[model samples]
Target chain A: MNAIAPSFPAHVQTGALSIRNLSKTYPLKGRPVPVLQGIDLDIRPGEFVSILGASGCGKSTLLRLIVGLDPDYQGQILLDGQPLNGPGLERGIVFQDHRLFPWMTLQQNIALALKNHDLGTAQKQRLVDEHIALVGLRGYEQAYPHQLSGGMAQRGAIARALVNKPKVLLLDEPFGALDALTRVRLQQELQRIWVQERCTVIMVTHDIEEALYLGDRVIVMEANPGRIGEQVQLELAHPRQRDTALLFQHKQRLLAQLVGH
Target chain B: MSPFKALTWLVSPLALLALWAAVADAALFPANLLVPPLEVWRSFADLLATGELQEHLAGSLSRLSLGFAAGALAGLAFGTAMALSDTVEAYCAPLFHTLRQIPSIALIPMLVLLLGIDETFKVVIVAKTAFFPVALATVEGIRAIPRSHFEVAAVYRLRWPTLVARIALPAAVPAIVTGVRVALTRAWVVLVACELLAADSGLGQMIEMGRQMLRIDVVMVGVAITGVIGFALDFSLRRVERRLSGWQVAGR
Candidate 1:
């Protein structure tokens, strides 16, 4: 695999996320039902962390909290040593669905994220073009979401999320809706992009192989009032081969732990 | 369209015309009541040549445009307000719903008494007819917007104006446009009915005059023209609706 050099300017390292004793509950039939409890995690800048869990595991909920979508959680989520407020431009996220405005073309959708940024029109256009190219979606700028294939739309979503140059990027099962072949292809593309961007990434997924393949550290979570179960650290380099025995071994170990649960 | 498909469209009209000719030939009713199709056609040509049809049509169309514009614009504003603000909804929704249930025709008598049988009465009635469906659709459309859309806006940190204009309006467009289309056709029908009840000049007034003069062929001409105009209005609006919402995938 040819590794592309990072195209963005080298700014001071900033994205370091810390979640301490985070707990959340949703009201079920008038009583509060615990969804997440006592979760503590500290992530360094430029780290790729994959959170592996089953359905009802609250993994997605954890991401929603960190992204500041829902502010009804208990605990301190500090970003770069400062208490995080509601969603800021520093954090970007991609949901399972592409969520592109159907009325807008790919280029327009990506440009919309820069609506609040203090940049000139030409500068915003450059950022949009660069991100679209970064996601390998050149020559498809004028296509609307419906006109694009499922995988292409998801790629467009990724470009939109990255256009703002957020310090931290979150992905919630970003490939969950794709076919097996498309999912695999997008995983490769995601790996390549992450290697080049080198931003802090936290992805939530149930696919063990995907987690082991991309994550610098994999955190396994258990359901029933979701909590961390175990952690696995992968001492691997970028542009790593997908079919390596090391990846297979880690996948097997994670599978055994999850199946045993 | 294929030649065969185009031929199929004419089948029903031809069948109806043949049936009418047979009935008239058999003298199933009085000749004056069921005028021959040829006589009606001649009357249509005479009205066209004299420009009486054009005058009545222009009068009716102008009323429709003015009334529909005022009513649809008000509906859009009021509906958006009701959807956005709980206080507005709470105060107005009940009265709005109750008023909507009463047909515009029912209000014609009261409206005539208040505003007289003039252009104002017809315009007011058409405006009232246009408002209800549009307001209802706007409320429903805005409410139906998925929460996911709002979440995306939140994540992007979009400001208020951006959020409303870019997100909310576009998301609710298909519904609002559909509502406007319904309101327009409904207003046209109500405008004609109002003219029928009382008008110095209009297609409806022309039909009434034909009835008084025992010119059944003229009445038939007016009826045919009315149907054609209504159909043209609906068909054109449908095209606009399809064009505006071309982004929507079928079955989605």
Candidate 2:
């Protein structure tokens, strides 16, 4: 915890996540179709891990399982050594679409995520305001989702997810629908926020460059009963430049690996 | 409105009045039967002075309010139950659909025979007219909500009340409001028709009396007033709908 505000407690080293022999299947025509098979991974606290894969690689499914959206899977998911259950405030997720309710203003949307918290009204309001400002949406609190551009709405979603101060943040192709320029800008914003917050993050995406850019470690996945194929540890530091020689090399290697398969 | 747009608004009504005046002047039909626009206007003034038009309007409006309120409330509850529960849907859907298919006018004679040609008959007819559209709208509106919304609700761990009030109801509002508007207009038309058939009061009764006495000017007054009132009802509800759904993305 960098010295910013002493009143706010430092985030404990608590988001360590471990998955062992995780498998999931869906019913199709009354027959079970395997979506994920025998997946095992570990994530350290405050680490950014990106899962890179093709469209049908079950990367999103993996995120959904970890987020506790679907509990019908076969596996053990432990958060800080505790077994997982259904969704809790300890974990937050951002989907491909912003998913903000069109009827609510941005402030109201963010405030809604704090409804379950046992905090004072003023405290919740402060948290909502801080998160909105954190995502660079301070001035547009009154704007509705439909009134916002796609990138701005996604940022609002990020604010809503973070307002709960979840120990882990899951990104399911968070910027997949964005244009190239907006995607690049939002990736940088996400990286900056991650550094400031220092929470565990698992992002699923198909963009190899993005995976290499922000992730401390990138896990490449194979489709057709999705499973881990390869892992690359990036030795680069935060506040990284896009034109770095190391990132270019990693991107080239990742492209060849994905294409060669 | 811009000056040009305001001028465009005047063109249609003005053209209509001019055509009526021209036809009357040409004596295209018997003078009494044609009923010049000025003669109709005089009859309107007489009705207003005698408070006859106000009495009829008040009676019609009160019946509309009572019937619409009862029908809409029942429809809302029933529709929600059918949408949310398979048991209710299994038992009620077929019967509801068949009943809705029969126009309210078709039931007026039978309803009059059973309930007599009184307030009960008019109110029942109006309610029947209001029920189908509202129920249909409620069912479709609630069903139209995307699955993604419920997922978000689950993720947030929203309670049942929060889910219904904050997520479900607001999401379904646009559809529900449209249904209410449709039901309201339809109910008004049916009420008038019922009044024409058997009522002792209301705008429809006024027109019926005008025809019986061969007072073409009085009949013209009733017809014009009904048109104006219907337009006003629709216009106001449309404005309300726009106000409520201002957050929707245009073209979406």
Candidate 3:
């Protein structure tokens, strides 16, 4: 039960996220309704952090704020010690409903992420191909979003998000819409991709097992003017086994914390 | 095209032709009014051979193209502006709605008085017909684009040009195309109607001339040609729409 920060490699000096005294309120009928309350988070480079919370706990909202999709929050969200003004190429996100442009083929869709990059055509194609293969969608490059199943579409979205080689990848309950079996499979796939990319990642989810399985540190959040409730550190190495008693123990604790007031 | 599909399209024309011939044989209403299909076909062939029908048809098609191009371009610009800018929308929306409600047919009399039944009036009427539907569709289509797409654009930090070219245009294409199709066909129909009321040359003018000369066969030929040409335009436009929207309608 060490509450200390995890040790990181000295060589890879990128993607350190810092959130300080972050609070957000949405105006509901002319009155300010607090959504996130004094939330502070610091994530190391190349770390995988999962945020778990019930609905309306500001978990997704936190991801939105972190991704710079919503810039109206009170406090600061800094990446590499610099405050973010709006969305940039350094940050990428995967939404729950795979938001692939239905008009573009899978390969074209992935290539769209590289539009702003100053890369040549061959390099862009190589990056898109590599990311498509990274998400295990090699042969289905020409397929459209509607042609692929929900799971495959989400994988394509992941490939699109990662094609830019973003420093921080934010997932807002990415596999929330999939069936349980596909969700488990994608969780493993996501872990592999995370390890390969070695980018800072923050995924928000309600699934207890998913969070504990993928996150190096699981941050549990509480609702009603959403605030961070507790943090659990899983010291296990990559390609984690779901059958571990340690994971089960953490899951039970998280469940109790979430539901037992 | 498959033989089955060809046969399927043939059914309606054949049935209508059969009914027309039967009525003509029975001398219903008068042989003069209900001209037989064979006589109408002969009239069509004679006009085709004499090159008069070709001139009128060519003139109508040229007018359609010119007027539709001008109107559709304007609609696209106006709609996109109104949608993207709140000030434009606030100032123009109510007037746009009110103008669109006044049918193009109803405006013919007033337009004749104002523009004096010339090529300008005809072209302007055709343009008016093409404008409203396209603008309405463009506005709705732009508005209905999923917010997530804009979020994706922001994440990628797409520039304004890239955003419009890639995200905005493609996203609004399906709706815009439907509107364009409606605009084009409506423009054609309204142009013909205007020509019927007043014109030097066109299929509609030919019909008016036929009525004054008591050549019901020529009028019937004009009617049939108008129907056929409209069908052809609509079918071709639909094929274009399908090709453009292949990503959505292809697999499904």
Best by TM-score: 1
Query: Going through the candidates in order, what is the number of backbone clashes in each?
Result: 0, 0, 0
lDDT of each: 0.89, 0.89, 0.90
Candidate 1 lDDT over residue span B179-212, tens digit each: 9989988998888878878999998888989999
> Looking at model 1 chain B, which ten-residue stretch has the lowest summed lDDT?
B243-252
TM-score, candidate 2, is 0.91
TM-score of each: 0.94, 0.91, 0.94
Q: With candidate 1 superimposed using the best TM-score fit, by how many Å does residue B3's alpha carbon deviate from the native?
A: 1.1
Clashing pairs in 3: none
As for candidate 2, its clashing pairs are none
Please give the range of 10 consecutive residues that has the lowest summed lDDT in model 1 chain A. A1-10
TM-score of chain B of 3: 0.95
Instruction: For candidate 3, write residues A79-156 as lDDT tens digits.
Output: 999999899889999999999999889998999999989999999999999999999998999998999999999999
